[model samples]
Target chain A: MWKRDEKKPVVGIFGFSGCAGDQLAILHMEDSTVDFFTSADIKFFHMAQSHQEVPEVDVAVIEGSINTERQLKELKEIREMAGVVVALGTCACYGGIQYLGDDEETFKERMKYVYGKSGETPEFLDLVGQPKPAQPISDFIDVDIMIPGCPVSEENFVPIYTKLISGLLPQKYPMPVCVECKYEGNDCFLLHGKFCLGPVTAAGCNATCPSLDISCVGCFGTYEGANYPSMIDKLKEIGLSEEDAIRKLKMFGGNKVEQALKGD
Target chain B: MKTYKMPKNVFPDFIELIKTKGKLFGPVKQKSKYSFEEIKNLQELDFDYQRTIMGVKKFLTPPKYKTLTFDKEGTKDIIDEPETNIVIGVHPCDIHAVKILDRLFLGNIKDPYYASKRENLIIIGHSCLPDDKCLCQSTGTDMVEDGFDLFLTELADNYLVWVGSDKGLSLTIAAGELLTEEISDEDIQEYVRWQQKRSSMFKTVMPSFKYMADIITLNYDSEAWEQFGEKCLSCGTCSLVCPTCNCFNVDDKILMNAEGGFRERMLDSCTLPYYSMVAGDHDFRPDRTTRLKLYYTHKLKEYIGRWGQPGCVGCGRCVTYCPVDINVITVSEALFGEVCETKEVCE
Candidate 1:
């Protein structure tokens, strides 16, 4: 229990090079917005407020992958200044969709495809210092905790926030989305010869898609110690070629999935 | 056991009489599958179903439920007294499954949650014709003598109702004029013929089911387990559909305000990840092969060792529900090499 006279822990919510969905998730906590604002000192959340600098904080919650040299330096600075560094979304934890192209040449080719061989885009790229390959924040700094999702789930976020504010270390289970799917009492899509990554995907979204009869695309990233060879074989049995199955597995799993597939 | 004969025409009125006892539930067809759903009238029930997607266990131990609610003051047990439930059209195998569950939950040390639901539930068994998926003949659960309040044997033109409990007798007394105590020779002959026909109609017989405990032990390290494990999706569908798979996991769900929370209990499966995980993330059964072995061993081998009967009632739910064909029939056949249908396992 915190005493009335105890100082509130300062928290900073920062975003880097991808969609700011994680910060939006925090803002979307409608019922608990007041409680969150009252409990902690949210010193620097640019999405919620402006005219704020990166101050020394008790906790630094980061979102998105590091795609630029400037973001890489700022990430290191935040790690040095904050007591606890949290990777708040799939991008910060696994490099997200932005890191799908792992090699420098592929990144350059994709950049050219999206922006064209035009002049203004090159100047913008020069300004950002040659546009490094998108990488997770943990590549440069030590991450104390990882809350992975395309947009972090509110059920996961709220409880982790509660524990962090209460000065307790939050714990997470490494179970697959199939666990939640079973509890939801949804029919298995795989049983009907449909492609679903639920057996290997992380559990957090509460099997949202499968509850509605849609197959899981595994946007939450792979669960720890996932049995990938069996998942790939199942996908193959469902009529997906081995290549397509591996591609779908790597779609959201990023470098971690790549390493796991390599190890297999 | 007191017996009565009711004409087919008066069965609807008997059902209506029992409706006043509690909310009536029976099997209803949903698209291609069947499930136990609440029904207000008699026409909604489809007695021709082979199996319901879920079983009678759903009413006893729900998929998820709030067990406790707490705040800064203290925690409160939110174990509300559930309403009375009358489940009709339950098959004999399901009745046997419930009896096994009773031995676990209502035995020596009773679970308050299960005890409450079990007390308020009324089981009305119904005779059914065996389909190819039915394997109850091998497990000796093809017919039930007890474990239900009332049991019905459908005849050509009449209904034979057997009262197995005082509640069933009370229901009979309440069902005045709809039933008659007179038992004619024709009615007896019809019931015997129906029983004989049903006993002969079971096509999927596991002749080696009784010897599975020994076979499983002998082939504990067989390569067939690895072959089945390779095909396993680890999706936990088998445990969810199995009437006897009653393991559960409990967790505390804190409110968004962080001021209060509730404790929740949800059904868990041994085949799923983290079912055997402990503190420091040390999982005793880390791979699918070991976990699948535990599931079958506990159901087929260990339960027999403890209760003198295997936990499986030959409901065939796992056979119908598992995405890949990894069920009792396949596992037992593979272990004993009785059938070579799954040739890879036999080899």
Candidate 2:
């Protein structure tokens, strides 16, 4: 994955089925965008650049989740060519919204709603193969770091990005979003009878949603050792069914919720 | 105290005069909530607004600010002290909140960043109409004896103003032609009547407010916290809006070159699970219930010990804003031995 250029780190930005929201987060870095682009040599970023060549880059910031066989193949190739892979958003980190599926059969059945006549198109199968249940980059490749957010906030991304470019191993804070929300002084959504996944969700976004009085949707993956069973009990106490709470927990990433569902 | 009377109609021109002095901020009605924002038009200032969505503590301590900046060049202080800014139409609870914040930020080491902003600040307090959500009256925060630059009490045709500081006197003198002689005895009586009326408007009270510190300490391992934690988003909303919760975190952001970046300040919350987490992920308050308990303990017990004042001024923002309705009053009552039947509010 080592590139010819020895001066600056060559970077490639990629996306898959999920909304390119995490990449869009890069654009929202208005204060640091110029410095970011100037510091890193962009090898391939189809979202921002016109001409693209997927040359071996030092690092790749991959957004979205792997859903199709073609995407899986592309992901493996990316892993082969990139030295360090950073999962750039909730989708790439937690399988995005596709994690809502409880099983493979249900995942395919839900795909029918998207593709329209899922079994009818031979052309689709020939090019992309069968759609798979969404999974994080860690499932397919050796991910070096994971930055989770719906559209990653600058405060979270900038520090991590700076660390990567500085050749330092990025440190991950396993705190929940409540850490940031408390700092910003946001009101608890659960108190207002709104279902917020903040208590169990990973911290980073500086509690963006709650600052503006919006409930956190757990766009960031679940916190480290997140107590999902307790969160489910919380949702139940707040008037949501256990199934509904589990479904909402699986809204972003299923790894933790799946474990909780299996009584982990 | 020097008193002046301004006709209700001349209030608009008087506001325009205040604008020339500095950036004027007042309560602006947004959909269902009111916020302290730049007052562009006189009509935007609500004379009888209920409460602002957030407390006035935010003005003293911003959400994000640069404390220091370091580079290969040199390290230097970069605290951006603001110019003279006026926050008009402040409610009594928030005025009391500012006072609590002042005791914290200005009490000990004297935070230079907070002092810089506080020095340039001017408060214009408004006597507002009370609603069911307001508990400031019952809590003795219905009126501020001091701390405001100018306090306005509206009468039928004019506003009864009390100049609390030299800054208030200057503002009052600036409105030379707009100002009249001392408020009439009838107007003073009207102000007194409004005070009584506001005092009678409180619908909710934390029965344990008087002995909150002792009550919270006595119930260190209360089961009610576990119940509230079961429904807690742990978003730290209570601490943020408490006005007295001034905890902060500082981080140094270095540029890739390791040459330069700013050391910035961010808000920190005790209610967060990570607030007590140590090295090697040794979380002291790993559970949500534990964290929530610590937050209440700080506000009610620890803070009261630190300063003579009780942390909560009964602004009731936490109750009004809690999405799931874990009221402080009800929770405190439960902590102090009252088995509450009502799950939502404590009356």
Candidate 3:
């Protein structure tokens, strides 16, 4: 539950190491950008036009996941200072694409690939431990609300933010994008022999890809009731193999698809 | 509303009558697929086709349109128009899509651009006679009861037109002498039978939209997502073909002189790594797996809960178009469970 104040709820938008598309999306809300700024008392939004001190917030919206040691500490501090913490995008809600290398060895290999042979690592104050696999904010801290989008859709973000400012908890959305795609009357991509991920992806985007003469690539992650095996089987029947199917499932979904396949 | 049964020869006469008012646009053959375009000849219309490659929304919110233009003097101009156009041969699913867009653009803030186009366009829908890939019946969107000026159901040799709105009634009157005032109960009943039979052709039926939400939430930590992500190429083909993916990127394209430029907005997908990039060079979704998961969860679970409807229409386009073959229904059923006792359609 959220409580509204006369001066507008204290809102903070923070980000970690991932792409800033989610924050950029906020900037892309050109029509409502001024309204959003005027309506909410933004305490911290690092990616936007300002970079002010982080203050106590009623609702702290965090983007990206905890991938580094510093991110872990900052997230903990954010949790301590905010009344409610919301995961703003797929990165925060489901670890985004950075968590692909879930295995410790693979993660280290990739890190080494990028960081080079640095025998001496830089030291910093408040450094805690070695970085673990990237995990959604919920895996580290309690997330009151999870806004899941590759970059959160203005359709979902605006209303949720307004409700939070007004002291009302935004209602959760449950349908998949396929439903909207059907309503749009576009031809089914599958029938035309095109692969799509709409059946399993969530629906805040209003099935944008299908409307544009393309198929959903499952950017928003899995819906609550995704039927993974059936989807895979259908893919195989239509000329894909089980191996290819698994690879596609884990592209954005990560270990979630692995567990579902094993009936875990 | 009056109904008339035009003879076979009167088909050309009806086309002539409608063409006299304005340009007639219907499903036209483009390579292998059907597209809605202006029709100058009756033979060009492909009424018996399966479905159009794209929805009728392009008429309202086109893929690329200028929202605002600015000059050196800080002068900004917004482009909007109120024009009259007629769209024909729209399938039931497309008509439903128009209604959804209406709810999105008009139901909420009343988007001036979309509203203007919506108000100016006249929609004529055709009842879908089930195809092998359609599952609209299960999704509750197979019929064209509303959101159209008129609806036509194709019979054996003639077409039964149901005038739904004042615009449709006006169109009917304009083509008056060609139409008949008498329509039989048998004709309507036969049309209904044809529709029901058409629905039976679909192979896949998803679970209730409510159940879909539960499946995604309960299995957040499921392994299926990771497996799918591994094989996913992250090419963004799925989102591009999705009918309801409305995410876009806005860029200010400056002219050579730098005095003025128009702000250009283009479609974007979360599946792309750069989709979430910020000014500080931080890329939020760095891998393909996370991008894939974001799309699935949003479509099946989150958006449905917000809008009170399933996001997918059971169109098999994603599965068909995906180069990597990441079928959404397969993943959804694998997480939730297959629709039991229902015969599999895709086999």
Highest DockQ, which number? Answer: 1
How would you class the docking of model 3? incorrect
Tell me the tens digit of each residue's lDDT in model 1 across B202-289: 9998777888898888778878888888778777878888998899888776665556777888888888777888988898998889
lDDT of 2: 0.76
The runs of at least 3 residues in candidate 3 whose Cα sits more than 4 Å from the true structure, single-residue gaps closed, are: A1-264, B1-8, B76-78, B207-210, B277-284, B338-347
Q: Show model 2 residue runs off by greater than 4 Å.
A: A1-37, A41-60, A67-84, A100-131, A140-144, A150-156, A168-249, A257-263, B68-72, B254-260, B338-347
Top candidate, metric lDDT: 1
Put down candidate 2 lDDT per residue, B98-202, tens digits, no spaces: 888888778868888988888888999987776777766546677787889999887778887889899999999999989888667788788788778866767
Q: Identify the CAPRI category of the predicted complex in candidate 1.
A: acceptable
lDDT tens readout by residue for model 3, B83-176: 4778888887777777767777787588776777788888887765665566666667776577898777778867788888888899888887
Comparing 1 and 3 on lDDT, the stronger one = 1
State in Å the error of residue A155, model 3: 29
Which portions of model 1 miss their true places by more than 4 Å? Answer: A1-9, A51-54, A117-121, A126-130, A169-171, B338-347
> Predicted candidate 1: what Cα RMSD to the true structure?
3.3
